[model samples]
Target: MNLFRLDASILPTTSTSAEIADTVEAEWAAAHPGATVTRRHLGTDPLPADAWALAATGGFAPEQDRTEAQREALGLATELAGELERADAVVLAVPLYNYGVSQHFKTWADLVIAAAGPTASLLKDTPTVLVTTLGGGYGPGTPREGWDHSTPYMERILRDAWQADLTVIKRELTLAGTNPAMAALRDLADEQHLRALTAARTAGRALAG
Candidate 1:
């Protein structure tokens, strides 16, 4: 088994989302001993700027007319697409910024979803786990609930574009000034997220067997 971990937190080493992602990787490694794990850090090591243009164009511009920049961009996009195609399971550690996923994660999504022909579904039916860290909770009836777009958007994109079986585990209310009770609730939520990942792994193994 192989698990691909994408760390989308913009913060250096201090990001809570990155911490959660590390924990998820640890848990996954524990559950599947000897399994291969690949990590991509998008915060500091962003894909080349031209990668987006290549993804949008579906390929490199005409070779003879292609500028050096365009060629570099196409190369980056092809590399990213290759990584996405090879993963068996994907784990994304996404931090909610202004109620949306980081722009880096979105860019990766755009490239991977741009594959051609039958390879377009290379990510289809793959198991995906999303860990989102937010400043405030977004469950039903919570204040600012309507602004909650991370999980729903991810679900739709994974299902519609990649055909992934998506599972989301959110840790919210990490900001200061929240009531102690609410903080505890958020911790509980994180724990539950771990449990959910365990279950998902078991199910995936069973299906493979």
Candidate 2:
């Protein structure tokens, strides 16, 4: 079986999102020994910022008239879409950045749309695990309750758009352990961490099965 894992954390070494994803992956690997895992790290090797525009426009241009850049962009879009299309399962490790999606991750999503069409279900019926982290609490009643603009948007794309059998594992107050201002919430953060890890294992077992 082939599993696709995508990570979008600028800080890999200290990334809670990645840590949660690792738990999920470990469970899958244990269940299916020797299974192939394809990994793409958008934070370390981001797509070209302008590729989406070129690819989006390229789709309208006749193949013969497309410029070299547009041709390359379109190819890249197809490749990104194919990675998702071919995966038996998927794991995405993304974190809230500035209260929204990271630009690079956004670019990647745009490229997938450009290649697969806005409504294409590239992962139709496929199992997908989405692991997202937040530095602060944004649940209802929190000061930033409505400030999280990343999760809903992603769920729209992954669950609604792509039609994946989606499972989301989200954790908040991730900065409590590191940020002095959030010192009082460290216990809550640890609890969230454990919960996320447990969810990952459950999700991973589902993927393996």
Q: Evaluated with lDDT, which candidate comes out highest?
A: 2
Instruction: Tell me the tens digit of each residue's lDDT in model 2 across 1-44.
Output: 89999999999999999999999999989988998899999999
Lowest-sum lDDT 10-residue window in model 1: 200-209
RMSD of 2: 0.7
Could you give candidate 1's per-residue lDDT for residues 95-206 as a string of tens digits? 8888887788878777665444323665687877777777776777877777877767776776666777676667666562356656656665666556655544554443
Write down the worst ten-residue block by lDDT for model 2. 100-109
Clashing pairs in 1: none
Overall local distance difference test of candidate 2: 0.94
Cα lDDT of model 1 overall? 0.69
